[model samples]
Target: MSYVLITGASSGLGKVFAQEYAALGANLILVARSEEKLLTLSAELRDKYNIDVRTLMQDLSLQESAEKVFAFCNREKLTVETLVNNAGFGLSGAFDSMPLEHLEKMIILHNLTLMKLTYLFLPDMKRRNRGSVLNVSSITAFQGIPYNAVYAATKAFILTFSESIREELRHYGIKVCSLCPGLTETAIFDKAGIDPYQTLMPIGPPEPVVRAAINGLEKNKNIIIPGLINKILIHGGRLLPRSLMLKLGIVLGRNKKAFLQNSC
Candidate 1:
């Protein structure tokens, strides 16, 4: 049977996406690093929604992890009708001081893994002539971010890639969407050692953001940016000079750095 497969399905926006899809009566294949959490989420969804829920515990950051996931799904005959590439993390610090390992993992997980999963699932989706792909990017994808350089670039890749494919798949009745959420209430900031409450921007909840994304996808919207403030910032930032935008990003990055230092 066809199912929606979501990466990073253990917590944060990923977990929320799982719930949202389940609520819509969609069967799910939840992939994440934590087996315990994935199993728990699967049980909850299965019990509440009475839909088939499969769990795959794998770290997308590792080499060949995406292939393994594809293999697992194929073995189980779980045809993926919707793919949500939502697994990613940010590292906040000066590019020179940040750990190269973390950057590499971000590159693999945020960019490579998403690409592979999409590629693996695309042919089947084409054959079915019906599918949806939701790529969870960030508002930072609209411009360069100094402290979170690699992370922003990876998300930028997602935004552009999703747009490109959205056009190509339109003729095949496949929906491809890029969800560029601004600051949301998620553990990503905590993992990055940056506090969202200390930031200047308004942080939103994951529910509305994910809701807007799924709704947009249903409407066949290619780019889904949630929240009024974020929509303004993103669209307004495009009108500003590139140099000014970079400068503004630098200032925000510095504030984030100061907060991280204080927390440490």
Candidate 2:
């Protein structure tokens, strides 16, 4: 059977996606940095669904991890019918105070490594003429998010990149979708150093995001915004002038903004 490969499968939307796919009777290959969580999830899914569930514990923040994941897929003969590039985290507080190593890993995980994995697997999926790719971006991707400069920028790259390639893959019958969910209840907040309350406003759980993302993949929608309020916020931000948006973002993520600016 074809398999759904999900990075960041240890928790949040990634974990939800794994469960959703298994519910749909799809086999899975999960990847994450948390070996304990990954192993637990792998066993849980296998036991729950009686589907073949394999896992790889690798830090996607590392340069070689993408290559390793790709190689594993090839060796296992796992036809990656779906790819969920969902592994990422954010840092809050000030940019300057954050370790340079952490910043580098952020870029590597959010941008380069994700792009690398996509590029590696996409060609084979296209040649086979059947597959879906989901890049988990965020509503923060719309414009410059003050505190989340690099993370937003990386997501923006993912958003545009996925849309452009979605058009290209039309003929190949491969669908590429970018899921731009707003603030969800996840560990991303703790990682980013922002309080969950600091998130724009009230938001739904990651479950909707995962469900909508899966639906978007199946329908071949180029982009999926899981919540109506988030869709509104993203659109509203675009309608406003950049200066206003930036100012507002600073208020929302002051620690991040000041840190980045000071570091620069």
Candidate 3:
């Protein structure tokens, strides 16, 4: 049977994606670093949905992680019909002040690993002439944010890469979509050290975002921005002057308490 392979399936949007796919009666191959969470979710999904759920406790941030995941799927004879590259995190602070290791891992997880995984799986999809790749980007990809530079850049890459590959693989009947969600109520805010309440922007729930992603991928949309407000922001930002947009992003991206603390 074909499976939907989802990375970062331990929590947040990843967990939601797992549940959504399970509801569709699709078998799942969930990959994440947290073994306990993966096992628990696996059991829950299996019991509730009566679908096969395989869990792989592997961190995508490290080198050779994508290869290992591919190997695992091959060993288990899991045919991945859909690949969701949702394993990513954001780091907020002065780019210079952030730990180099953390920055490296973020880049690897967001760009290199995602790219490698796509490359590894595309051949199989091409052979079958049917598959989908949903890359989880962010609304920040549309513009450069001051403190969240690296994260935004990485997301931008995913968006552009997905668009490019979507066209390239169109003839093969493979769908490649980039999911760009804004300020969703996920653990990313806490992990990135940004308080969502302080941002003053509407924080959307995960369900709609995941729903939009799945729907968009089904329709072969090049990009899927979840919230209406998020869509407006991305589209409106394009009409503004580059300098003005940068200034606005700087103001919006700044963490209030951190800015005040740094000032003092």
Candidate 4:
């Protein structure tokens, strides 16, 4: 049976993706660093959906993690019909003040690992002439976010890469979509040290975001931006001057402490 392989399946959007796929009666291969969470989610999905759920615990920020995940799927005879590259983290602070190691890890997890996984899995999909890839980018991808520079840049790469591949793989009947959700109900805000309430933007739930992404992927959309407000923000931002957008990004991107400090 074919499986939908999802990275960072332990929590947030990744976890929701796993559940949504399982609900669609698809088998799943969930990869994440948290073994306990993965196992728990795997068990829950299998029991509720009566679909096979396999879990792999690996920190995707590591260099060789994608290769290892590919190898495991091969060894298990798991035919991945869909691959969701959703493993990522963000660090918010002045670029110079952030830890170098964390920044490097973020780059690896968001870009390198995602790219490697796509490269590893595309050959199989090509041979089969059928597959889908959902890359979880962010609304931040549309611009240069000041406090969240690296993360935004990584997401931008995903957006462009997904669009490029969508065109290239169309002949092979493979779908490539980039999911760019705005502020959603997820742990990313806390992890990135940004308080969602402080941002003054409406924080959406994961269900609708994942739903739109799956629907968009099914239709082979190049990009899926979830919320209506998010759509407005993205489209309207394009009409503004780059300098003005950059200034706005500084206010919107900063954490509570940074925003307060700047306000004073």
RMSD of each: 2.9, 3.3, 2.1, 1.5
What is the per-residue lDDT of model 1 for residues 14-97, given as tens digits with 9 covering 90 to 100?
Answer: 999999999999999999989999999999999999999999989999989989999999899999999999998868878989
**What tens-digit string does per-residue lDDT give for candidate 2 at 62-149?**
9888999999999999889899999999775556677889888988998888889989998898889888899999877788866567
Error of 1 at 143 (Å): 0.7
Q: Between the candidate structures 1 and 4, which one is better when assessed by TM-score? A: 4
TM-score of each model, paired residue for residue: 0.95, 0.92, 0.96, 0.96
Please write out the lDDT profile of model 4 over residues 76-185, one tens digit for every residue.
99999999999888678778898999999999999999999999999999999999999999988988988888988999999998899889999999999999998888
Q: What is the lDDT of candidate 4?
A: 0.90
Residue ranges of candidate 1 with Cα displaced over 4 Å: 251-264
Q: Report the alpha-carbon TM-score of model 2 versus the true structure.
A: 0.92
**Inter-residue clash pairs, candidate 1:** none
lDDT of 3 by residue, 1-264 (tens): 899999999999999999999999999999999999999999999999999999999989999999999999999999999999999987887789889999899999999999999999999999999999999998888888888888889998999999999999999999999999988888987877778788646787899999999999999988898888888888998999987787667545675565455446
